[model samples]
Target: MKNDFEDKMADIMLGEAVTALLDEDVAISWAALTDRLRSAIEIETDEDRIRAGLRAIEEVRREMHVRNGEKTEGKRVAALTEQKLH
Candidate 1:
């Protein structure tokens, strides 16, 4: 029972770490993602899984970029501050 509990805890921690790492990879740097991908391919453990993860991250990034551009474009012709006459 103790061993099972410990295993579950480790799994949770590992999942959290991977999530954080993926966030960083998508937001700031892709080094973590690249390294993980290369390792996965080299080890031949689960290339399909690794590729899927990469594709998902890429799609999210693409959507974010598109949304950001739309937001900026929408604000381009809008006034930032209201003009008030005293």
Candidate 2:
């Protein structure tokens, strides 16, 4: 059984990322996550844990961009890879 704090942290992290993915708005997603991270201090979550959660949330956001075909960086990388392979 996870601590309630842990569950809430997970929810915030994933929820923010999922929302951002759906909206396809990176700026808004980052802003919301930053707000959630700041609020975590008020909720007594440790700094290390909050940082880890933030990193995970960022990863989720990036993955969402990739999956949604909104990753221009990924496309550039793919092109580079193809050029090298040829």
Candidate 3:
């Protein structure tokens, strides 16, 4: 009974959580995360809901980090810049 927007939002939120838990590169796939979120929402248990809510919070934090451009790598910077920092 969820609308398209709600479903999409849930998937996005779930993706963020998995990304945070597994690290940005190793997180669960979007398809898998979405399925997991949907399953969590469908469950009647309070514990499961709480767990899923925690995951959702982690995901939001990760997304915020990316949005703020905090993540960086020396690998992408030129050798000269890297050397300057060292």
Quote each prediction's TM-score.
Answer: 0.41, 0.33, 0.32
Candidate 1: deviation at residue 68, Å? 0.4
Steric overlap count per candidate: 0, 0, 2
Better of 2 and 3 by TM-score: 2
Model 3 has an lDDT value of 0.56
Q: Evaluate model 2: give its TM-score.
A: 0.33
In candidate 2, what are the lDDT values of residues 1-86, reduced to their tens digit? 45566656666666755575568654555556656544554564576467547655655577666776757778889999999999
Task: Go through the candidates in order and give the C-alpha RMSD of each one to the true structure.
Answer: 9.3, 7.1, 10.2
Judging by TM-score against the true structure, name the best candidate: 1
Highest lDDT: give the candidate number.
Answer: 2
Give me the displacement of residue 20 in model 2, in angstroms. Answer: 20
In candidate 3, stretches whose alpha carbon ends up further than 4 angstroms from where it belongs are: 1-45, 70-86
Off by over 4 Å in 2: 1-44, 70-86
Candidate 3 lDDT, tens digit per residue, 1-86?
44454445555557555766576455565445555555555663665454555456556557766755643544446666878999
Quality of model 2 by C-alpha lDDT: 0.63
